[model samples]
Target: MTLPVSARMGGLAMAFRAMAYWLVRYRRTWRGTIVVSVANPILFLLAIGAGLGTLVEGSVEGASYLAFFAPGLLAAAALQNAFVEAGFVVNSALRRERIYSTAAATPLEPGHIFAGHLIFIALRLFLSAAAFVVAMALFGLIENIVVALAVTLAATLTGLAFATPLAAWAVTVADFPQLNTVFRFVVMPMYLFSGTFFSVEQLPGPLRAVAYALPLWHGVDLARTLALGTATLGMSLLHIGYLTALCAAGAMIARITYRRCLHE
Candidate 1:
């Protein structure tokens, strides 16, 4: 069963509409969220990069820790912002506030609710990335102005891809305890092992396979390579495809779960 052309377009329009709603409504959070996410990456850069740079004594990359760390900090924003937005906002609305019931009663629908959440998450990731780019400029992490915007766009998409399961899972959670376990067992492992802070080469041979298996790995690879001015066009498209597929699968699964839960 293939979707008709008109049906596909209409579905896309609805998703876009849902996303737009969150973007417009959350403009007020911009200033403060930016402050937190912006400072976070910087703190990581300084604490892990400079602090550890002293201990390594110029052996890790034969360069300053700042240079090696800029990419890691950028990738960290993708993981952090996406996770925070998904866990915090989704859990609050679905678990704490029961806002979804109210929203579901409206014309927006559950799918729209999901889109709205992802849109907000995507926007936050973009802002967080932008803030890091500025910090990078101050710290001399970037020389190419073009790569800054590229990194942000990549991070935005990648954030959504890596967060797909968490976002979808948020819809069906009977309680918050599961979320803690998911974060501890699933997301935390992805963050630590997915080349977020270091090269995948550092992974043990068996564990190296896990790095390539993660959506974040593709995103981080693309972001770092492009930001460094080394990636090919094909690589860029591959990363884009990976993120798109994850988002689509997530939305589809979420729709199924939401419809079953809400309609029943």
Candidate 2:
């Protein structure tokens, strides 16, 4: 039988409640989060966008390299922060802290638990992106403040595109070391090759193809375009579609994986 609307509403309430729990806990640790999510990215912007940007004499995509590079770093920082929350934190909740077990005993279903974490991840990315944008503004990198909204949204989507799948993968991991392996091999490589520092056009044909296949490239492109106010609507829609598809598919996979792994 189909569930009643009230029941569905209750499920959503439970999910948000679980998200609130995370937020409450995070408040105590917001300092570290700010340092990692906000400070580090700004430092990188200065180090690379300003420091190295000086040695570079040409414009990228008709803007200074600092202008071109800041947005990509914002998205990359979002992806990094979101993956940590969804991947390592979620895995710890399941295996180490066993909070999911306690949550499962309540009205919250496995899907609710998964959805709650996803929601928190989105929130985290938005906050991180906002902070990064403010930093960019301080550095005179942003042409228009309103563009930060679009860039933040893109960063959030980019983050979820990676986090959802990583969450599912985390559930199956045997130990912390394996997660490190994923970061060193997968995440780090993507960070380097996703057009964060340079255009994919600079890559060899084969490497460029690989960059095209990665979600970060799409995120970087969309964010760069939006931040620079140079995005064509058609291309922006295409990038949004690509990231949205990955997020939806990954969330579905995470739901299934959580059900199986958590025995929901």
Candidate 3:
């Protein structure tokens, strides 16, 4: 039977309430996160984009090395932060703190709980991405404010593409060590090879194929294309489609996992 519109709205209200729990908890710890979100990009831009950038000759994709590298780093940083939140934070809530278990006792369904947490994650990504873009602008890497905003949006999308699926898996993990293994083997390799620091074309054919399949490469490419104003309509659509599909699929899996975890 079709539920009434009021019922749907009520569920969404519950989801937002769940999201509020994270936001309120974040108030005490937000200062540290804000510092890292702003400082990390500036330091990277100085070290990698400015320091190493000078040693490299010629422009990359018609811009200076700083311009080329900043957007990729922005996307990469989003991915890393998203993973940190989705990995250890989510795991702790499930295993150590049992926050989800407590919430399960409330009126919120598993889907609402997952949605609420995912909403908070998206907010976190937006703040970090915005800060990174401001840092990019300080380096004179971005000319157009609109493009900078687009790059920030692209980075946030890139983060969600990884965060949702990782959160889904985090629901099932029994310990912290498994999360470390994922970071070491899965996330680290993607960070290195996903066109963040260099072109994926430089990789061997098989490695290049692997990079192409990863969401980060698409994210880096999309963000870089926006930052450089080099994106064609077709390529932009392709990248957005891939990232959006991953976000949707991951959210679905996360909902299912949350249901199983909470119900059990």
Poorly placed runs, candidate 3 (over 4 Å): 1-3
RMSD (CA, Å), each prediction: 2.8, 1.5, 1.3
- List, in order, the clash count of every candidate structure: 0, 0, 0
**Each model's TM-score, in the order given?**
0.85, 0.95, 0.96
How much lDDT does each candidate structure score? Answer: 0.74, 0.87, 0.90
lDDT of 2 at 141: 74
The superposed Cα distance between candidate 2 and the true structure at residue 124, in angstroms, equals 0.8
lDDT of 1 by residue, 197-247 (tens): 777888898899978888878888787776666779998899889888998
User: What order do you get sorting by TM-score, best first?
Assistant: 3, 2, 1
- Candidate 1, number of clashes: 0
| Residue-level lDDT tens digits of model 3 in 29-135 | 89888766667766988899999999989977678888889999999999889988888889999899999999999998999989999999999999899988988
What value of lDDT does candidate 1 attain over all alpha carbons?
0.74
**Candidate that beats the other on lDDT, 1 or 2, i.e. the better one:** 2
lDDT of 1 at 73: 63
Could you tell me which residue pairs clash in candidate 3?
none
lDDT tens per residue, model 2, 1-264? 999999889988878998998899889988888788888898999999989998889898799999999999988887798778888898899989998888888878888998887888888888888888888888787767677677888888888888888888787676878888888998999999999999899999999999998999999999999988889999899999999998888888888888988883
In terms of TM-score, the best-performing candidate is 3
Which structure among the candidates has the greatest lDDT?
Answer: 3
